[model samples]
Target: MQIEQQAAIVTGGASGLGAATARALAARGAKVAVLDRNADGAAALAREIGADGQAIGIGCDITDTASVLAALDAARAAHGSARLLLNVAGIGTAKRIVGKDGAPAPLEDFERVVRVNLVGTYNVTRLVVAEMVKLAPLADGERGVVVNTASVAAFDGQVGQEAYAASKGGIVGMTLPLARDLAQFGVRVCTIAPGLFLTPLMAELPQAVQESLAASIPFPKRLGKPEEFAQLAAAIIENPALNGEVIRLDGALRLPPR
Candidate 1:
């Protein structure tokens, strides 16, 4: 599970937590593949890592099975079998199931969120696990580690987050079973349910809005940093016994109902 010189695949590597994890992995000497739908951003990040030969950029829409398959194939071609799989690609939106407009939020929107956030994670995880099983195990017989991104909303979703919460809940539910199934293969699975983080998407909000969200935290009263999440991922990959759990990086803050 030592990251050095090993192949790692990071979905949504173009920005946010995904980008941070990819950079961290590369910095730790891992051959990283920046997989994302944002082709330009992914390519730019790969170049910035200064390992164009070892770091690659692959464009993919994780919701589409064919697109994900192609992305995984491209990564395998570039860096051999990937031993680290990071599932960080997802989308979120807020809408009441019933609205003042006299019509409920479109079902398509809910489906889209679930498809990308939940199904997408499963798609990439399945493909990567298959490939990881083919590789020879490392010391301690560990073949690979999968780090998935969930959300604090899974446990404390507000009024308008029905779709988002359900999707994240699915990920949290799968973590332990996945670890149990992959254990014999020396593949560890864990999920990180992050609270508010200073990701690019959140940066778009008004300053006051951002501050309000941060202030809601019981301690620190600030957004979590991407590097903090990356640190946990690094630790999970190295610790053989830390499997089958969803660790919240929420600074002891449980969210309130909105």
Candidate 2:
């Protein structure tokens, strides 16, 4: 799947990982549609990349089917159907299934996490695949590619991360099956499980806490950068052989139980 001249949709494109991906895809010469709930932020980014003349910003709530459909329609109108789907919009709220008081956590807490991270990912992927199937296949019969975002917490979840972990774990678990399901359609699916990184949310932490987390990494001894993740995504798009795998971007660090 060549990134050049292709229509790419990036969820959560307002900031963090999605933002980085939008910039990366644009740098690679692809027409990018920035889909995010932050309407102003998304529009700002599209303008930032407007030099390419193929970038558009759409406000969307991936958890809602109608919202996603509207966004997809807007993206299609702006730049044809998307050939690259990047599912990076997600919430990371840490909560224990059982609070310190031992009372069961509110059901909404769990559902909210899954809805935004897991269900939202599927919503975008499903709609993107529907469009990709309609596009003619390129070399090697490849029509499109989907890259989902997960977290190391899915495997090394600590205390107070039950909901978050489960949501990400669902992403990792679905990778292979999704790849297989889309294989016949010449579509590929893969996931990225990133470890502690200096995203905007992490940047909000105190310096001491940030340093502590960085020190925890075995090598490099620093947080992962959004650009590094984008680099990997570009590689994945360039290499068709990469599919149906959850590649971890942690710097040789296995999170400890908190």
What's the TM-score of each model vs. the native?
A: 0.98, 0.98
Q: Residue pairs in steric clash, candidate 2?
A: none
Worst 10 residues of 1 by lDDT: 49-58
The sequence of per-residue lDDT tens digits that candidate 1 reaches over residues 89-157 is 999999999998888899999999999999999999998899898889876899999999999999999
User: Clash pairs of candidate 1?
Assistant: none
* CA deviation > 4 Å runs, candidate 2: none
**Residue 151, model 1: Cα distance from true site in angstroms:** 0.3
Write candidate 2's Cα lDDT for 44-96 as tens digits: 99999867568999999999999999999989988988899999999998777
Q: Pick out the ten consecutive residues of candidate 2 with the lowest summed lDDT.
A: 49-58
